[model samples]
Target: MTDATAIDTTGYLALVRRKRLYGTLLLAVFAALMASGFYVADDRNAGGFFDGLHRIFDFPAEIFSEAFQNWRNLPGLFLKFIPSLIETLNIAAVSTLFGALLAMAMALLSTRGLALWPRLTPLFRRMMDVMRAVPEIVIALVLIFLLGGGPVPAMIAIAFHTTGALGKLFSEVAENADTKPVEGLASVGGNWVQRMWFGVLPQVAPNWSSYALLRFEINIRASAILGFVGSGGIGYDLKTALQWGQGKYDQVVAIFALLFLTIMIVDHFSDRARARLVKGGRRA
Candidate 1:
């Protein structure tokens, strides 16, 4: 009945009082502690409590200089580089294919009602959780030790890790799929396998291929690194070149540029393929 627009002075004052003024002081203290910690951890600093500003633009001039020197030595460089590149490609291709198969199996298991063991959703999810918790590099390190440092260990590592990762992602995609076709298949007395084959696979195949191609690009990089552990690839050569020093640095840069360009080309082609797939899907 009074002024409806009037503020509730008591409530407003109580709310203002409840605001924690100490929050800003606490935040400042936390920020100061973090800054001090970062300063202490910085390598560029002298024996002071804080490190000096880091030289962020320290480029390796030696690498460029060596690369220029080796520009005329292309034939000799190719002899050392081509085998490693092929090995890397082989690792990537085999691992990606294996991972795709494993991902498909795991994805089928993850769909809520699609699997035979519908009650084992928690178990399946937990298993996937465990698999995905471990990083691919860590897995590769372990496998290298267990299986003896070779391409086999690297390929297995890539396969298992990719399976876990792609499986989880593919499972989520499968879950989000439109249920109408699945339900239709069920109404026609279709079994789980039939529904999966005729309904889910058709819809998700393009997305699955897109993801696989992306993974392949990542695999190429991983394969290169696997050589660090004696898994055999361009990374091994790169490591050798680094250790050799001076003359090899240029060659290393050249080889690295080639590897990077290869990945870029793969990415470009994959993007085009994905676009074409999407367009074709839409037209259909």
Candidate 2:
């Protein structure tokens, strides 16, 4: 075998010489400028910044104190908050459920390779882009203005946003699905929808279900924020508590903690369900 350690100092130095110090310096300067711009745009005072920074060290204590200050009054708080919380969940559930159904249709449209009229592809893509571009809160605010405030507006807002996001994800999944079963279905003279139903759906159904469940959890959080614009939910309670300054910061904090717990629990269950589904599918 030939020895291979023949590299020289000149070549090594030449390699090192190619390192672009000016490019790196330019990048550092660009980053610093961007950060400075962000800081200026934020308009936070130095004193307020320092105070907020100091509070981070005591955040856990602050959160705990805020949650537990009115432990005795929690039952009454719960009595008042439960109805709104239920309404929030209902809004999230109905929104995600109905939105997922609409997303299923849109998803079919998104996978242009599966569609005959390719012209519809751009239109569907643009539709999804538009829907997803508008945030749920903006949608809720607009719907509230148009339809008047109630759960309906909130539901519609959540549903539209959910459909947009879920459609995009579902289409990507569908597009990447195994084509073998689809080919078999086509060979057997099955139609497009039939091929999708039996072949594509079976392959991606588990992932789709998991995505929909995950979206439900997200919609719950969105539903909470919808109340800021009078859409009604836990957010309304939070807004009221803040506005009234009735020393109900503790109540608001407790409710928020509860919302956090609910999300965590839902995530755990959804993960378990997805795992079970994946395992069952593999076995089948």
The candidate maximizing TM-score is 2
Q: What overall lDDT, based on C-alpha atoms, would model 2 receive against the true structure? A: 0.82
Please give the CA lDDT of all the candidate structures. Answer: 0.80, 0.82
Spell out the clash pairs found in candidate 1.
Answer: 66-250, 67-250
List residue ranges in candidate 1 displaced over 4 A: 6-37, 43-59, 278-284
lDDT score, residue 246, model 1? 68
Give the clashing residue pairs of candidate 2, or none: none
